[model samples]
Target: QKEVEQDPGPLSVPEGAIVSLNCTYSNSAFQYFMWYRQYSRKGPELLMYTYSSGNKEDGRFTAQVDKSSKYISLFIRDSQPSDSATYLCAMSEASWGKLQFGAGTQVVVTP
Candidate 1:
């Protein structure tokens, strides 16, 4: 299996829908889970970070990690057109920095 796998989705939905983006990894050594939001041609901005398996919430964004299953998810509540962007899931084994990222999922929130 690859270190990390994610579908590069062009998932389209209405503005008010709840959106979910996910990724799975093969490495058990990964200790950090992160979610990032990226606009076209721009670098991804970190959205959420979790040290281990659990849930972290910030505003309309929620990140969930399941270390036992090597699965991670990002949930966006009350989606808006502004939320339309590529969502990336990343992980790291380092205690300080450097992350390994998925290919990213593209989302379109139509008004």
Candidate 2:
């Protein structure tokens, strides 16, 4: 099985909708959980990052990690058309650098 699994969703929603994206992992050694947003033709940018298990929120983005369940989630509140992009979930055993990423969920927010 893949170390990390995420629904490669071409998830579509209207503007102002709350979107939820998730990922599950098989590795218990992972210590860092991250969510990255990538626009077309651009590199992924870090949206959220957490160590071990906890919740982190910034603006309309929230990230949660459950080490015991080996799951992680990202929630976007009031999603906008500008938010349309591919969301990637990542995890790593180290502090930084290398990380295993999910297949990525494509989200399109329409007006």
- What is the per-residue lDDT of model 1 for residues 1-111, given as tens digits with 9 covering 90 to 100? 678999898999899999999999998999998888999999899899899899999999999999999999999999999999999899999777688889999999999
| Pairs clashing within candidate 2 | none
RMSD of 2: 0.9
lDDT string, candidate 2, 1-111, tens digits: 999999998999999999999999998999988899999999999999899898999999999998999999999999999999999999899996589999999999999
After TM-score superposition, the amount by which residue 58's alpha carbon in candidate 2 deviates from its true location, in angstroms, is 0.4
The models' CA-based lDDT, in order, is 0.92, 0.95
Candidate 2 global lDDT: 0.95
Superposed on all Cα atoms, model 1 deviates from the true structure by an RMSD in Å of: 1.0
Candidate 2 residue-pair clash tally? 0
Q: What TM-score does each of the candidates earn?
A: 0.95, 0.96
Question: Which has the greatest lDDT?
Answer: 2
Residue pairs in collision within model 1: none
